[model samples]
Target: MPSVDEIRGRIEAALPGARVTVEDLTGGGDHFRCEIVSDRFRGLSRVERHKLVYAIFGDEIGGPIHALSLKTLAPEEAK
Candidate 1:
């Protein structure tokens, strides 16, 4: 079970300059919802963008982290 800051840190570290917001939905650290904005997501499909973020977690997605809901966006798509 990862902390909110830990999840945010991992995403930020993986996508330098990205704006990441992670919330622990269950309060147990296993379910989370994250929104990430980054230039790296530009030109990528929605699935591709999600895959990029998901890759950062690897096996942790189904292990300690039970569910991770993501909202990935390119800089231009962010508001």
Candidate 2:
């Protein structure tokens, strides 16, 4: 199981300057909710934006990370 900070690190690495937040949704590292805001999401569809984040975890998706819910946004879309 990955720690929340570890998950956040991976996302930060993958998106460089992205603003990312990862939470252990169920008090278990396997379940997470991630919010990411980045310039890279510009011009991409919602699914495409999610795929960018998912690509970073690759095989880990069904392994250490059992459930990952995402809120991906471009900087302008962020609150």
Candidate 3:
């Protein structure tokens, strides 16, 4: 199981200047919900923004990380 810190680190590295908040939805290590706001999301559609966030997870997305409920937005949307 990846630590929350580790996951957050990976996301941060993948998307610079992203503001992320991760929550464990279950007692198990797999389920998580993340709120992500990044400048990279600017001018992107919702699907594109979510895809960007999910890409950071790579294979772990469906394997180790069973679920990731995401709320992705641009910096402007966040404010």
Candidate 4:
């Protein structure tokens, strides 16, 4: 299981300058909910934006990390 900070770090590393917030929803460190806002997401569809984030985890999504609920947005879409 990945820690919240570990997840946040990976996202931040993958998308530099992104504003990322990650939480361990289950307290067991497996389930996570993350909101990411970045210029990198601009012009991308919702699924595309999610794919960018999901790519950061790869096989971990269904392995150590059970679930990752994402709310990804471009800078202009954030409020």
Candidate 5:
């Protein structure tokens, strides 16, 4: 089971200088919601941004991490 902080770390590491927030949606480590803001996402399509984030998790996505709801934004899109 991956902890929220662990997930946040992975995302932050993958997107250097990104602002990431991870929430354990169901009080379970496997279910999560992530909000990511990064300059790397600038000009990328939504699918492309998602794919980038998903790649960091690899096999863990449908396995240990059962569900991940993502809100990805470029720096300018962030509030």
Candidate 6:
């Protein structure tokens, strides 16, 4: 079970301009929802947007973090 701070660190490290808000949706550490905003997401498709985030987790997507309901936005969309 990864802490929110650890998840935040990984996302921020992988995507320098990212702003992330993560919540444990099921009272457990596995199920989560995240709102992510990044300049790196600009012009990307919805699948691509999620893929960027998934790439960061690598094996953790199904190992530690079971589900991540995500809302990914470009920086301009965030504002």
Better of 5 and 6 by lDDT: 5
lDDT of 4 at 2: 81
Residue-by-residue lDDT tens digits, candidate 1, 1-79 = 7999999999999999999999999899999999999999999999999899889999998999999999999988888
Clash number for every model?
Answer: 0, 0, 0, 0, 0, 0
Which should have the higher lDDT, number 3 or number 4? 4
Cα lDDT tens digits, model 6, 54-77, are 999999998889998999999889
Give the range of the ten consecutive residues with the poorest summed lDDT in model 6: 2-11
Off by over 4 Å in 2: none
Give me the runs in candidate 4 sitting further than 4 Å from their true place.
none
Candidate 5 lDDT tens digits, 1-79: 9999999999989899999999999987999999999999999999999999999999999999999999999989997
lDDT of 2 by residue, 1-79 (tens): 9999999999999899999988899988899999999999999999999888899999999998999999999999998
Per-residue lDDT, model 3, residue 75, is 80
Instruction: Mark the regions of model 3 whose C-alpha exceeds 4 Å error after superposition.
Output: none
Q: What is the C-alpha lDDT of each candidate?
A: 0.93, 0.94, 0.85, 0.92, 0.95, 0.89
Positional deviation of 32 in candidate 5, in angstroms?
0.3
TM-score of each: 0.97, 0.96, 0.91, 0.97, 0.98, 0.91
The C-alpha RMSD of each candidate to the native structure, in angstroms, is 0.6, 0.6, 1.1, 0.5, 0.5, 1.1
Residues forming the 10-long window of minimal summed lDDT in candidate 2? 20-29
lDDT value, residue 73 of candidate 1? 90
Q: Which residue pairs clash within candidate 4?
A: none
